[model samples]
Every structure is written in C-alpha cells, then in structure tokens.
Target: MKGYLKAHTHFFLPSEQMAEYLDLPEKTSYSALPPAGDSNQVLPLPDSALTLFYVGGIGAHYKLNAFIDAARSIPQIRVNLVTRKKQWDEAIASYPTFQSPQIHPYHLNANELDDLYAQSHIGVLAVEPSDYRRFAVPLKLFEYLSRGRPILVTEGTEAARIVSSFNAGWVVPYTAEAIAATLRRLQGNRAEVQAKAANAVSAAKVNTWADRARTVADTLTGKSK
Candidate 1:
C-alpha cells in the first residue's frame, strides 16, 4: 500500500505500522516537557492533592462520558474535562457522574488547558473508532508524555500500542470496570506509579516532535527513498 496524499507523517507512520508493520526508518526525537521551573512560575492547579485529566471532543462520538463515569468510582480523583465551550455544558449535563463533587468538569482555554496537563498526575485519552479519531494522534498524547505523567489509555487501537510499546502507561479495554481497576492499582502502588511516570517522561525526552517532523520530511523528500 502507498501513503495517503493528504496524510502527515504522524498519521502515516502509525497507520503504516498498524496496517502492515512497515519498518519506517527510526529517527532521533525529543519531547518539550517543561524544565525545572523558577520562583516566578505559578502552578495553577486546585488544592486537590491528586488530579487526573481526561481530554476528548465534546461530541457524542469521543466516549468521554464513559471516562467520567469511571472516574466517579475512584476517590479523590479530580476529573477535569478539557473541551471547548460549546460542548461543555451539554457534556456536564449528560455526564453520568454529573453531581459528584470529585468530578470537576472544566472547559479550559488553550493556556489554561496546558496548565491542566502540567499539574495532573495521569492523562487519560478517549478516542473511539470515528471519523474524527481516525489517523490522528491527539495532542494530549504527546502533551502527557512531555508532562512526564503516567497515561491511562483505552486499548485495542493504535493509541494502546504506542503507550504499551514505549512503557509509558497502562492500556485497558474501554470499560468503566477496566479503567477503574487500572486507576485503583496505580493508587495502591505509589512507587509503581511514579516509576511508570518517570519511564514515560524518559521516553518522551527522546520522541520529540521536531525530530519526528524531520524524519517525515526526509521520507517525503526522497532522503529515505
């Protein structure tokens, strides 16, 4: 099979791997996880000691409702929803865990959203088999990596393989029981959680977007051909 005419390298590499295990040339890369902050840096997270972020489109297809439901079963797990304003109220109202105080649903602006990534311990991604999700790696995937947080991804797709292969985090089936169980295990073992987080960050340090882009550029420019 050949590459899609309109596809970017990010889409191409993953799709190629998924479809036929094509051996794309490996390239050196790095992540932009923030460096040690100075005195001027102000962390804007709430007072909650443990916060978790779940990002997805506000539409019905993203399956964020399932994530919020799972989060409610876990104690002290602040479920901050990162989404646009138009979909925020509807999402809140439709969410199965609507009234739970532990479920803090916020519609963050771009910068505020980035702050959420910076402050959270785990990053959850909800991507289903829909047109919007196909062949695209959500920014949250890399953002979580860059933040050095352990990621909890719903498995059986490309996202799961990426996390599992890199030793970045846990990949479970898209079920409340599965998600709840994974979070519980992480909560039970703080040392294990921290170790996974460190491993993810270390992996991110090498998988930089700049480097991914350059390799893609080479592939497209005949450097790989």
Candidate 2:
C-alpha cells in the first residue's frame, strides 16, 4: 500500500511498534485536540466520600464492572456512570454491582455531563487491555483533565502514559483489587490528589484545541513542517 499510495496523514503518531510494522519513516508529523473546557477555574477540593466518575460507552470493553467491584469494598466510595438510559439498563441487568448503593447511573445531556464532572472527584478510564488501546487516547481523559480532575486509568495505554508524564493521575492494573487499592491510596492522600488536580489543569493549557488548530494552520501555511 505504501508503494501504491501517494501519501497519508495520521491524527496521531503511530506507536513505535505500529510504525515498524508499517515501515514508516523515523519521524512523522502529528496533531491532536487539547482539553475541551476552561483551564483557569480553581481546582475543587477532594470530596469527603471519594467519587469516581465515568461517562461514555457502557460496552464490555470499558470494564466498568471492575470499578463497581472496587467500589464494593469501600462503602464511602461513590461511583457514577453516565450514559444513555438504554445502556444504563443493559449494564444494570448484566452486572449485579451496578445495583450497589454506592453506584449511581445517570443519563445526562452535554451540559449536565459538565455539571457531573464539576461534582466529581476523580475521572475513570478502565479500559480492558487490548491491542487497539495502545494507539487510542480516550477523549474522556482530556475532558477529565480539562475539568481539573485527576484520573484513574488502566496501565498499558496512551492515557496512562499521559497521566504519568503529567503527574495528573494514577495508572493501575485492570482488576478490582488494584482499583480498590488505588482508591484507598487516593483517599488517604487528599493533598496528593489535589496536587494532581492542579497538574491536570496545567496540562490542559498546553493541549487545548486552539493550540492544535494553530499547529495545523502553521503546517498548512508552511510556517511549520
């Protein structure tokens, strides 16, 4: 295909393994949107009861059941899953943990989703380990960072790397025990969580859509290459 095609562009730089597989050049131009909200807002204090917020697909790949299980051990921990009513119903019917008193499921509009983020303490991205995850950066991760919320993401994905690089969140294995342990760690270290929250906002400032757009414009105008 490389020999047959003239050129192509990537929304993001392919992983080293992927580049090697495709026999791509050593360097490639890349572009990505930054955080999607105001970055100047004051960071919220950690909630008294640890609140984990997840808003997205309720499919099996998300591994939200693990989070539900994790919440079971900590009665004070609250888990919120926001999705469409249909998906919510399917999730509750498929997973018993969805019925837990600590778990709350909601169907929210876009504005309400922002409100939900405001009320939450931590943003969660519990993707199951898979090959596709290596290249994908979930949008919710940026949304979480934009809202100045620290993240809890699974290891071995781009999201984990970003969180680690920015010191904006924790990366843990995709298991109930690991999740529960990390939750406890965050709960005991309120100051640490607050620090991470501040870092998230700082990170968002550098990765906003406006910045990405400027990069793209520069590239098109021969100002950058």
| Best-fitting candidate, scored by TM-score | 2
In model 1, the runs with Cα more than 4 Å from the true position are 1-14, 17-48, 127-135, 220-225
Per-candidate local distance difference test: 0.62, 0.75
Clashes of 2: 1
Tell me how far the alpha carbon of residue 182 in candidate 1 is from the true structure, in angstroms, after superposition. Answer: 1.2
Candidate 2 lDDT over residue span 103-156, tens digit each = 888888767775667678889887677777776677778778888888998899
Quote the lDDT for 172 in model 2: 91
Deviation in Å, model 2, residue 97 alpha carbon: 2.0
Model 2 residue runs over 4 Å out of place are 1-43, 221-225
Task: Write down the RMSD of all candidates, one decimal each.
Answer: 6.8, 3.1
What C-alpha root-mean-square deviation, in Å, does candidate 2 show against the real structure?
3.1
Q: Report how far residue 121 has shifted in candidate 2, in Å.
A: 1.2
